[model samples]
Target: PSVKSVIQGFLPGLALKIFLIMLPKLIMAMSKMEGYTSFSSLERRSASKYYLFVLVNVFLGSIVTGTAFQQLEQLINQPSSE
Candidate 1:
């Protein structure tokens, strides 16, 4: 396998792992910056932010990417004479 292909395969998973590890801390920091003085409030805001991130990134992103790939495939496979 070529180095480019290997890096392409590995980099996304590695980046995703790093992002997942950092996301909670990042959200917590942002929440603190937003000035939630109580622990419960901070946790609540952080959890909501995390949930929104997951919903949009994972669910909506999957749907959008899947549809885009399907369209690209169809376009590529379609005959020019049509």
Candidate 2:
């Protein structure tokens, strides 16, 4: 099997999971840093920061997922040549 398609397919799923996990943490961190406590305050902070988090997560997750797929391909497919 060609490693290229596997890498592409694996990356999007990994990136999505990474985005889901990272987004809330990113929002909470930014909210706390800005001293937001109440629901409204946090909502406002999260509203703005969440978009930034999405952007950041997309970039970072793509990089990470791509790297992970590359490593996976190598580990799975690299033959023990004579």
Candidate 3:
């Protein structure tokens, strides 16, 4: 395959990887802002945030194309049965 084609594949997966890593840390930071009284609260907050991210990805992945956003247009026009 051409370099351009390889790069196109690499970039999205790279962005998703970055997002996955950053998301939990972002939640961790935000949780501390509220001065969480217990470790359990912080842990629960992080898990909930991560779960939301995974839920969105799993739902959208069903309509996968070269990239997630590209499939959204197709899904929008698709009939419910699909």
Candidate 4:
């Protein structure tokens, strides 16, 4: 109940989640305009952008009353038996 109550308090996170999902595609579109000389370079740029997105979303997000770390904690707490 306590966790559920905390999760239910924030609503805008849904929109942020949606934007993050689409971020990679957005990076690809911009990469096309940049005209990279090699396919690997384009892929690398897109990957860098995606990682930056996650880094900001995880590290900076924790500064707020967000669930990023909570989910991380849940993942870390799982048994290694799996």
- By the lDDT metric, which is better: model 3 or model 4? 3
What's the lDDT for all of these models?
0.91, 0.80, 0.80, 0.80
**In candidate 2, what are the lDDT values of residues 1-82, reduced to their tens digit?**
5799988889879978887777777787778887877988787778777777667767887799899999999988996678
lDDT per residue for candidate 4 within 1-82, as digits (tens), equals: 5877767765567767888889888998888889976878988999998899788866676766466677778889984575
lDDT of candidate model 1 versus the reference: 0.91
Deviation from native of the Cα of residue 72 in model 3, angstroms = 9.3
Model 2, backbone clash pairs (residues 3+ apart or across chains), number: 0
Q: Model 1 over residues 7-67: C-alpha lDDT tens digits?
A: 9999988997799788988999999999898999998999899989989997899899999
CA lDDT of 48 in candidate 1? 94
Clash list (residue pairs), candidate 3: none
Model 3, 7-56: lDDT tens digits are 89898788888888888888888888979868899999889978986877
Q: List the residue pairs that clash in candidate 4.
A: none
Best by TM-score: 1
Q: Which residue runs does candidate 3 get wrong by more than 4 Å?
A: 61-82
Worst 10 residues of 4 by lDDT: 58-67
Query: Could you tell me every candidate's TM-score relative to the true structure?
Result: 0.85, 0.46, 0.62, 0.53
Order candidates by TM-score, high to low.
Answer: 1, 3, 4, 2
